[model samples]
Target: MTTSTQIQRLAIVTGASTGIGRATAVRLAADGFHVLAGVRKRSDGDRIASSRIEPIILDVTNDEHIAALVERVAQDPAGRPLSVLVNNAGVAVNAPVEVLSLDDWRFQFDVSVFGQIALIRALLPTLLSTRGRVLNVTSVGGRVAMANFGAYSAAKFAMEAVSDSLRREVEPFGVAVVKITPGAVSTNLTESGLAAAARVTDTMTPEQRRRYAELSRAFIAQAEGFARDGVSPEHAAAVISKAVNARRPKTRYTIGRDGAMFTFMPRIVSDRLLDAMLRSQNKSLAQEKR
Candidate 1:
């Protein structure tokens, strides 16, 4: 396999600005892949350009950026086939269903689900030819909705559904689909998601605000704790590297201690028991009003 990589070992990683995506891109490059690291900001691209990675502007939600990426891959000097596509670009929303603005919900799905589908669609020809893999970087929330995380979980759940269907459909073609579910990955995503949720809180009516006050406060603290407890993004990147190189990778890889525990527990417990366990973990909601 090491010798075969010389044929066309190109890989594209979206959301390479920071976190797991950046780490994965760097790791793949170290493993001898011609990595195209995608970022939405010029500063991000500049930061990663120092490495062997070739950074490109890729806002996954934008059709134009997707098109540009396709063309860039198509024009590979070696005309090399894309060996892998890492759909790591995503946004998060923290509002409850009642007040989750329609736009917020749409925005969550826009990047995580719809944009990924579009990327796969445009890149399918290349992927099929190369018999490459598609790795969707999802969350533990995809398997089990977390408290106060309906908007983000909903998007990830949908991503899981499509990935399942896609795997079956493309397996015959030698194209693989794998989901990377990281639990509380120590990334800026937690901060950004909580901040976005705060904005949603501001837009609420006084009555609505009061209704959400307690749980929302708990939720914010919960997100912070999750971020603090998370393992380094490099650990998650290592798991992703394994997935890309495995002869027959598992359907999913869950990173972090919490990620592994959550994934395992869900399989053995009944749904009702799982709900009880989840609620037990939501002790933040039990804190007395301050």
Candidate 2:
């Protein structure tokens, strides 16, 4: 009989160019899984490739890339069973619902929601065969939608629902679906989000700008603060690793104190109270910029 030690395990992590995805890829490789690290550019793939971590070009929004990834998994030279799929590729485009273009909203959902689901559909067969785990790197935004974050938050909220539905659908089949909800981490998201926010602000009408410009700045400041005070990608990776390795993992795993708080805060607090709290915090952040 083949011992568990003798069987090689394969894990795939998307958006592995940097931050949490990169960290998780490295962590899983260290844990003895042969990792397929997904990156958008060839240079990035080259940068992250290792003996145990093979970098693959994967733009989650691209169907051809998705097909290629499925093929790669099917043709693993070592015949290892795929044990984990980390749906970590996501982009945040933050703007007021009225100000953000329909195209922008669709783009956010395209990468964060549809792309994630597409990959899962492609790999569900292999995952089912191996009784593998699916780890979705979602955000606290899913639970608490904040002002000026409607597009990004909506996508996360959708994924949260998807995660719940998927867990129920797959759990009985021996496939584990875990949501890795992170509040904030010192990643490039803040910088990218700020840039996107600036572009959106430029497109706003003068009336719209007058209404939301300061609020947008406040949101930007808050994002920067989150990045400055947030946990490291390695810490997020450790949390994710725990979820991946657990024999019977919880349906959801929150990464930080903020994650835990915001996730459950909605359950305990009334919407009116939550709104007041968010308003107060945004006001404080806006003042700090003065």
Candidate 3:
């Protein structure tokens, strides 16, 4: 028989196969939440589940999957109002605006923007029923621009705007929208992003290629450095968990040292100065690749 303490809150976490999403799902399960881990692949879903975490096949890009997940959660015996919805599934495609293919641009926007919005729309009814919390996992890139990451930054910026609007709109309904931005957490995204950068640059004009090559390499190197310095996914999960449980959760939570610095520095520094600083970083990165 399951004890009251064992009676878990129901949470649906997208992108639970790896990185922050996986960590959040696991941590929530450990915290006595019956986690519905969402992954694109069945294999990844299976990998996400254990005695505590229950995996669910979810492809954010698929409408059927999102609808099916909502129905499944609604039918749970726990009938517990969906306590949390963590929108953590996202992809990064780093390329210069000129060189980036339309498909690549749309792909990033689809997963990070359209898909995320769709999931929230599908689940908003459940969240409203339970007066639950919605956590949008944004990135520090959303707040500031980075060369070679225009596509990713654009999507994130749009997501942040979406989150801000939703936060205000949902407050009266007692559903809180929280935005958590992490600077860099050791994850495969950097490696994959670098690989995509290489692929995109291959089709670029010689001058465009020459300009982006060093910049891209430097960007990758920086990403690698971030991965090395980044806190574990578990650490990010813990911080998120606290936000979920807090009596008065803040609208925004910035994770990691770099995240905090980038988030707050803008208030103290002039925009032009900040732009110069960022440009300088890019220039230095380019030089390093030479």
For each candidate in turn, the TM-score is 0.93, 0.97, 0.95
The candidate with the higher lDDT, 2 or 3, is: 2
Instruction: Compose the digit string of candidate 3's lDDT tens values, residues 1-290.
Output: 23354355788888898988999998888777888999878889777778778888888999999889989888987666588999999998988888899999999999999999999999998888888999999999888877778899999999999999999998899999999999889987777777887788788898997776777767867877768888889999988988877778999998999889988887899989998898888778667667
Which prediction has the highest TM-score against the true structure?
A: 2
Screening candidate 1 with a backbone cut-off below 3 angstroms (N, C-alpha, C), the clashing residue pairs are none
Look at candidate 2 and give me any clashing residue pairs: none
TM-score of 3: 0.95
Per-residue CA lDDT of model 1 for 1-290, tens digit only, reads: 34456335789999999999999998888777888999989999988985448999998889999999999999988767799999999998888788888998889989888999999999988999989999999888888886678988999999999899999999899999999999978888888887898899988889888887777767876777768788888988999999998989999998988788777777888989987776775554446324
What candidate 3 gets wrong by more than 4 Å, as runs, is 1-6
- Tell me the lDDT of candidate 2: 0.91
Q: Per TM-score, what order, best first? A: 2, 3, 1
lDDT of each: 0.86, 0.91, 0.86
Please give me the total number of clashing residue pairs in predicted model 3: 0
